[model samples]
Target: MGRKRKTKIFMIMIAFVLFLAGCNFNSSESSNEETGGSEGETKQVLNISTTADIPTLDSTKAHDGIAFTVLNNVNEGLYRQDENNEPIEALVTEHKENEDKTVHTFTLRDSNWSNGDPVTAQDFEYAWKRVMKDASPYNFMFVTAGIKNSEAIMNEEMDTEDLGIKAIDEKTVEVTLEAANPLFQSLMTFPTFLPQNQKFVEEQGDQYALEAENVLFNGPFTLVDWTHEQGWKYEKNEDYWDADAVKLDAINAYVVKDPAAGINLYETNKVDRIVLSSEAVDQNKDDENFDTILEPEILFLRFNHNHPVLGNKNIRQAVNMAIDKKSLTDVILKNGSTPLDGIVPKGFFKSPAGEDFRDINGDFNTGTVEEAQKVWETGLKEAGVEEVNVSINIADSEDHKKVAEYIQAQLEDNLPGFKLNIKAVPFAQRLEIEKAIDYDLSLSSWGPDYSDPMTYLDMWLEGGSANRMDYSNAKLEELVASARTETDLEKRYQMLLDTEKILLEEDAAIAPLYQDGTAVLMRSKIKNLLVHPTGASFSYKWVTIEE
Candidate 1:
């Protein structure tokens, strides 16, 4: 969060256009408020809005931010990030690591799934195996790559049972890794590492996690209702091991794509918190309820290498440098977001020696606009094309369309004869489009899964599931592979730095537009609602709705 900027006239134009289009906007979700409570009483419930629909609640298949947000609330892993973003014991009492840091052992707390089944160490063992064994539709198995035999299991070269995680006893779980992973403990905080009740899963079969009744919760909340794309509701879990710490009785979330609609819900006192768009921010920065949230998220353009023009390195570099990111963020997105020139966002992580990584390896391809045009001309010639027709795919959200239109205009205006097409699809469809690599360029953003540089760097490995662009570089892969096992903090940091340079400066894998920052109108009465710089966006465990 930072000081607010003055509104630009162009920002108002964009908002006007959205309103003229007659975008659909819903009111809000109905809540369970006490009818006969005391005069000073208020219901411990939070009403929030999401920009997109959750694709899945299945831990092994969910990869989007929306799904992670819900799963983080309903599932407890071995560890969870506290208000300070520090790893704290959740399901486990404590964890011990060997000197080499390849082996980890965790002792379980006497927690229970919502179904009355005692949570056991075997639950984690089953979840890890499930992710690796079923790497179809989604390959979240890559998240557990560093674990011993995990890669082999993912490749189908070894049996899932051969994975190096074991339940020594009903209450003890042990994990072994192929190399020393500095971020192993931190990774446990991800939803992919959450435990699963095998019996419950098998019984539910294909219907598992598809609806509120299909999923079982072991975290601070339980899914009481789900209405698909509309929204969902979570009630505080009475069976949670730390249920006493959960202050909120219920939380309701709605999917509101139009920022204008979200603001309406907030104004009418139907929602407690609403994420504001740039236009909305300009209109409401003076409000005492407005708060800026700087995120460790980066918005970028993913180039599908399958495209004839995009496959050329020169073409990719030209596209990367041609755009004016400053104009995109300042003029198009007047929110707290800042233009970015690299994959990793600034202030996301620091070296063990305590220096900003962005400072260490400044901006890349940050040359003059004139230089960018020259390269673009040369790239067209190299690709043997007089003009290139490209399509940029993006989510159908109001903010996403605004940014996409800005990029489309920039490319067409700066690079002569460049024809751009914009494909705006629903959030769920956009994910499928990306997975299929069905477009030339994709507007995408990534939030860190854990507090490590590897979370971003490893996403583009040759055949990585997250590498929607299909970009690959032997040197970048080598550096990433080396860094994964390097116990020396300094050396590992250097390798990570080198990998970023290769991806951004040398290869131009993707065009990094800006670092995401959210402008929110949260009710002042809500207390202890924590947002982390990384991992999950909101934590409701200690949150209370006070009068």
Candidate 2:
């Protein structure tokens, strides 16, 4: 799922710092005394805060970072991403490929779910077939992976049982792909591919994964508590196959949208980490524990192409060119985020020619006020309208509210005859509205599911689940389709590059805003939290809290 493919509006905070205030140390001292720990004793508890509550725990339905991160920790997939963001065997003991490299088989390792059910190859087969049958939001991932018959099954032309995946035995699973995909291994690290106990899911039925108790976990940690919209808790899974590698005994996560409240929690020894808002960043950048993580997540304005005003290509181009992305990133999002004119973030991928994709594509829709005014006039003329009223849906977080306000100002001030409205709602509600195409425009973001340009390029596929913008081009679809199955590395890269051009430059499908950079405060005692630039974002399996 690229930052589960639908990035949520939450900032991840991974470390912490002690407050110099003497009285604040009382909580730490009390906690240490309660644990009977000395100066160098290892404290097995981790405390952190997320900006929003997790939307869901169902692996097949999770399409955002919060859910993906939680699912990644509580469920074991065939493969897991190591600290370096490379695929490492997790539930799978061994894997082998046939002569054509299309047929692959994996041997399951001895592992058990939180409820004591054995993790088996059949669990994987059941889970994968379920994803196809349900038409999961991430079903396109299987198609992108070139899984044999996956496309046919998704199109209802073939049965889910014939989707080229099978449990050859209790411990062995076989998978046949339409073609050899270099990224297939990496794709396994995503939460969407995590195995599910068939019986447990069938028993839970409609209530499955709605809360912590309803779901079974097979990863390093098992969700112990989930208080919707408030917080959640996790405990180390003692039954895990590699429990010895797990360091943290418990992880307590809270939904602290207010930056000040999060900082207060950190200062009072209640939490170990908190992400800083732009203003908070300025105030805490000199602190010893302050840090910044540049993510592949890209924020943009998604235009509803089905709408009359936005349906006009000229108006979309004008809207794209009118915004001052530089000011938005430099002023409002001062946490190292850079203005972006393209969907793919810089440093995310390099082509077969060893050049950055961003550099090769250059900038698009970057225009001055004078240039924008001309385009806006042309657009209004083309639409035969004196003015157009539009609203942008955004998460009600402080950061998003500020960004949306700035965008609202930019578009209104720069583009004549444009009236922009701001609609602020909770994060989960905002996602629902956008998915339903119930808004005129949406402030959206996407994090790569993998380290491939295709992660970003494929989202705009004509009728793709992620294509909520109603933006489509026959040329863009053709290029992406060909790029997915093209084995020639250079040719595939070129196709992706062309696809991006058609999506951004020609069609102006979305107005690129900025690449995300998270500023955070961390405690020096925390070690090896394992933050990835893409995918699930954070891994706590090896995180340790040292004195």
Best candidate, lDDT-wise?
Answer: 2
- The lowest-lDDT stretch of 10 consecutive residues in candidate 1 is 20-29
lDDT of 2: 0.86
Query: Who wins the TM-score comparison?
Result: 2
Task: Name the 10 consecutive residues with the lowest summed lDDT in model 2.
Answer: 14-23
User: Cα lDDT for residue 290, model 2?
Assistant: 97
lDDT of 2 by residue, 1-547 (tens): 5675233322222222322122122234444454454577776888888988898899988889999999989889999999899999998888999988999999998899888879888998999989999988888888977889998887789999898889999899999999888889999899988899999999999999898899999999998778776778788899999999998777778777778778778886778888999989889999999998788999998988889778887888888888888888888888889989998899999988799999999999878888888888887888789999989999988899899899888888888778889999989898989889999999998999999999999999776788887777988878987888787999988898898889888888889999999998999999998998767989999998876
- Whole-model lDDT values for every prediction: 0.82, 0.86
Error of 2 at 183 (Å): 0.6
TM-score of 1: 0.92
Clashes of each: 0, 12
The segments of candidate 2 whose C-alpha lies over 4 angstroms from its true place after superposition are: 1-40
| lDDT tens readout by residue for model 1, 1-547 | 3334225434544653453233222222234343224556676778788888778889988887888878999999998888888888898887898998888899998989998999999999998888888874334433434788877776678899988899999999999988776667777787888889999999999999999899889999998877766677788898888888987777878777878778766886667899999889889999999988778999999999988888888777777788899888877787788988988888988998898888888898777767878888888898899899989999999999999988888889888878889999999899889988888999998988777787789888887788987789999988987887787899989999999999988888888999998898988988998887666777888998876
